[model samples]
Target: MRSHHLLPLLLLCILFLAQCTKEEDTSPAENLMQEASKISYTYPALSTEPMQKASTLTAAEWNDLANWQLWTPQLKLGAGRLVQEKWHFALQHRYTVVLTDSLHKRITDARITLETSQGTLLDESRTDNNGVSYLFLTAPTKPEDLRLKIVYADQVFYIGDLNPQNGRIEKQLNIQRNVSPVMDILFVANTSLATADKLVYLQKELKEIINKTKSQSDSTLHIRLGSIFYGLHAGNSVIRTHPFILQPEPTLLTFTKPYTTVTHSPETIDLALEEAIYRQAWAKNASSRLLFLLLDTPFLQDPGTITRLSSLSREAARQGIRIIPVSMGSMNLSGELLLRSLAIRTNGTYIFVTHPEEGLSNPLSTISTYTDEPLNNLMLRLLVKYSKLN
Candidate 1:
């Protein structure tokens, strides 16, 4: 009942509060999943409301960033049950994710199967809204490969050899979702000397995709190919060259060296696009022409440039030219948002190249052939869609 007794009691309460705060700061689950894992969430904006969002953030940031909410799910006793269960099993494994569409939104009801590096099935699970599913194996384990198969509707995604002996536990899986056939495609490259390496790589890759598609289809598919090459201020301050149609072939034939480079100067994508409006050979062939732009920088950002770009986008949309812009280079999300806007506005695909051979919607590049199966599947899907619309 004295002042001394009250002081000791107050000190004890302060210490208790500090302990609680420290616990909240770092739990085992948080520690496991909080390793700053970067994930890309690409959804067409709910509206045209001008706002900025992070394209790269921690795994913790992803939960809150999904819908622009500032809240994350509170940690619970079962927060990382999958993590805990793995320790008990000899053949331990945990969360696997399923992403659908080019937007990479999580597929809620996808079926996931865990298997050994060999041909044995370990267990099965399904994804929630977060596209995460967990698995447990009661059998004894060996130091072999680990793999997963995710099936949704007609889509089948396979990610195998996920855990080698030296692999990390907290893993993020990326699988390409190749849709049905597509229309005749035109792949454009900006070959300004600065981005010349990227352009060279793109041309070689695009040619391979064309060749692969031809080999798969016994010359049954009818495909038309258009190729466009623009350089520093290409088509601007001079004449224009939007779509250069390749020769007719049994299968859709893509062009290699469809164009010859005149000069290497600063890239003027605005001028390149303006010429695209008049690229009738490609646009007239199909109602909605499919053009893929691989570039090292965003379009020029001046008033005249912006005006030309806006006009080009509108015209392209009207003439059935959907611009699929692939943003390369090391530009951050803020800078790359310009490319995103072009995709959204034209109702096309916006893909930011997170790595040399990943996070690609089209998933076709020179360095990797991971797209062979899926790309073939998508080509067929597009044919059906394009035929129906035409």
Candidate 2:
């Protein structure tokens, strides 16, 4: 009887130990799931009503908006440039170079090199389709010490030995060559289920703008419009890209496609942004490269996502691609921070769609109030007068 009792007790203790080991093995995964749940739970519901008045931002307001310190602390991890004081000062000292033909027409695809009198190359950039290039000089580097070497259409031009003070400098180069201004605008849209309704509104606004722009016959400005639609479905990111075209009808069709097949997962914004940055067919010698990102979803906050975004922003800036992020719905904290970071990083502007139902014309009127000039013309004016470059 004593042996039988001891055998049963031994088996019972073994089973108890096995159960404890199983719990220990699953605890980490369980904790991760709980944390994810908590994050989603804390997110506020998407707002149905407009949150802000539709108005234009002044130069002072734009500066405040670009300040990264005003954003959430989480943004600081990926966007180090915005937090650096040196980088901010460098932006202020930026100089603009505009190359034009003797007839005043812009020259495209011009290679510009900035160097010291000693031939130490400081920085170099190619003129965009708009015939614009930007260069920066740091402390201890006087404007008189700077020299420029420009190569365009197999001809080389040099300009140097100048005296410039602490204020902004705008240099004009009248090359012997002439090229028409080419503008390429790429519209990126999020097609996730959460933002389905906003997509409809965006399509209407885009159609009106496209028609209005096309109606204004500015032979000097050549405009090509394209679009990209992105979403997540069946654990995969789906992206459809349309190349820049002079016609708008086919490009507008993409915005009408239904996204009901999307899975329960949130949008793959990182992949969408990556596609917008790399896969699009931007004109090589175009004068302007503009990317308008429209979305209502919050981006993933994972480290990998943030790092990728940072890298993409830098690349876009290098390519002279301006990214304008337009918020379609009431903005959330995380969404606003990420959008603003991208805009600021690429030296682009941010717009909030306070009243989608009212269309983007009134809100964007500040961009171009004149019907004859249209949006792109106004954009160029803003670049010259306010932002100072395309």
Candidate 3:
């Protein structure tokens, strides 16, 4: 009654334990498959055909044509464009206020307030690293009826009877303080299986551009660089983000290395862009914030695609961050439309590199020149008038 019963009970217990171990060992793989199945890969119904005759266009032509307004005539000009044509000659007034020290050095972080003649606040913003603030007004409120006030270094100065309709207004304070302009740039690359061969070319072009931009920067302007590499492998998302740094060569090398890992399809571009917009260490008072996205894959139109894209683009626009998307190879209509919309929403540029294997040196050069210029300038008459202000 003792030995025989104990032997059977031990055998049963061993079989149960082995079964439990087997389930535990296989659960992880099962869970992964389940997750992969849950992912909805809804490609847009539009054709995947690439743009026609894109390869014939020169780099300079591409630079001029990359604007979103040219691509979509129905939509208004992007917010990034300072000068926009008024529809039907409507009274839409946009004013730029530039503050400078006596020595003509741009002032940073100065509090600017626009008020009405009746002591009502119209808008308020702090001057960016470029010592510029933007005030937008619509019809029924003329610039002549608005007054501008600036507060800097605990001192307040006031300018009344603004006439920005003619051009931007510049005010030179008697103070001698100067602040260096700050700019931040981040490069986001898609290192998936589809773009494996083009990574080397991209890496070389990026390094060259980085060096060029660095050489152009002097003590007057400070530049910080960062990068993000994104891919999907084995039903999991892989994203590598580097913080802003003075030197990003090592990070770029590691990110753009030869791709031997096999990646899954349906790029997580939305997630990569979300990380770029929200997770990056952008300066609060940066004069310019830019993101250069290189990708050939289209976004997976999942359930959260619209909401995520809308929120990300709005946030980028609010922060005055411009996104430059460079489509590396032949892109589908869906991908083109999405990227184009993002650029327009954020006042950014959408660039299509018809030949990715050739590298991006030409386009990068164009971008460098474009970013080096100032966003706004006052007309000669306005400058003359402003010079006489107290």
Candidates in order have lDDT scores of 0.42, 0.53, 0.53
**Better TM-score candidate (1, 3):** 3
Of 2 and 3, the candidate ahead on TM-score is: 2
TM-score of 3: 0.54
TM-score of every model versus the real structure: 0.41, 0.59, 0.54
Candidate 3 lDDT, 126-173, residue by residue in tens: 555466665545344765688988877778888888876344789999
Clashes of 2: 3
lDDT of 2: 0.53
CA error at residue 204 for candidate 1, angstroms: 2.7
lDDT of 1 by residue, 224-315 (tens): 56656665333444332434444444233323331324433435676667655564465233223466766655444555655566557645
lDDT of 1 at 4: 9
TM-score order, best first, reads 2, 3, 1
RMSD value for candidate 1: 21.0
lDDT of 3 at 352: 51
Best-fitting candidate, scored by TM-score: 2
